[model samples]
Target: MSLKITFSLTASLAVLLSCAAKKNQQAEADCPPKPCTMEFRTVGVVFTDSKGDTLQVKDFSVTLKATGKKLPSGAEQSTDAANPFYMIASDGDKSALSVEGDTVVVSGTHPSSGQVKKTDFVISGGRCECHINKVSGPEKIVF
Candidate 1:
């Protein structure tokens, strides 16, 4: 009788372990291995005047507020005349950018007016979000 009881307990333990392993495997399968998007993504700030004219900004720079590390600028779309602006960050940067809340400063000089404008931005991105997200920032800056 004792032997039968021990066998039953052992079988139960094995079943439980098998179930737990299956559950873990399912959880791992639920998430895609490469969930991030391959398409190029970027966050840009557009500069405009009070007249609503799209103004080109010069001497544009993007810097991380905490470390004061300047990030690389994204490629400009020369063919995109409709939307001329400065890129703050891009997913192409990979590890350089993090998904965690990061404060970024974007500054540029108005070509004609020679006026410099600085904008604070909270941007985030990484494997999960894939594309960068602009948490807080003016999409268009009116001079």
Candidate 2:
């Protein structure tokens, strides 16, 4: 009877050990270790006005902003200035942009008339599009 009891106790211990080993293995497989060096990035913004005419950097001055849950108010991120720049807007697209929360504010002197223009645009994805329209004599972007 004593021998039989000892055998039963050993079997129970073996089962417990097996379960613990499997649990440890599963935990390791779930998430791997990172090198600890990584960076966050945003997407570039392309601009246009109500006329659907392409804007160059020379046409305007642009300031890009990036914000997350931490800073809902938003903060300045980067400024792109290139030749043929529509004042400072863009001839094409901008890169090195973060994919996280980002907003772009544009205000620049009209390349031709030197009139100042101000507007804000929130870029969501690959298509961070902006369209300016004159409503009640105030230029605004619709969506």
Candidate 3:
């Protein structure tokens, strides 16, 4: 009698799992295809002094405000004086985002003054979204 009960429970569990798998498949099928561009998508910030001269912000980093998680920086370490662009986030970094998303702080230091400046950004994008966006904050910051 005990053996029969165990077998019945196992069969019922299998059936439930099968139904769930089918439901998941249907949900995936219902989702529309998200077309993405081949170009590498990235959010960058250009910093400048009050005089409108490009200021090189060194050691740029991103931090999630909610969890205090530090996102990786993809900025190159080259000393190209002409390019002071700071990377905020790239498409590949979408795995770190949650469905509801979170606010992030992009901080960096001025090369000459050593003054640290921070900018707040609301980033929301997942792997399905195709690209990350800077919901707020200026494209060019004058420090």
Cα error, candidate 2, residue 28 (Å): 19
lDDT of 3 by residue, 7-81 (tens): 999999999999999985675575568777888777778888989898878777778888888866444333677
Write model 1 residue lDDT over 79-128, tens digit each, in one string.
46676867788875544567786888888788798999888898886544
Question: Which residue pairs collide, candidate 3?
Answer: none
Alpha-carbon local distance difference test for all models:
0.76, 0.41, 0.76
Error of 1 at 13 (Å): 56
Instruction: Write the candidate numbers in order of decreasing lDDT.
Output: 1, 3, 2
- Badly placed stretches (over 4 Å) of model 2 are 1-59, 65-100, 125-143
Candidate 2 local lDDT, residue 122: 48
* Model 1 per-residue lDDT at 19: 100
Per-residue lDDT for 1-143 in model 2, tens only?
Answer: 99999999999999999999998567546444535323333223333455755344233434664432222222222454331222222212222233342456565444454556666554432223221111121233211
**Which sections of candidate 3 miss by over 4 Å?**
1-32, 73-79
Give the TM-score comparing model 2 with the true structure, all chains together.
0.27
Best by TM-score: 3
Instruction: By TM-score, rank the candidates, best first.
Output: 3, 1, 2
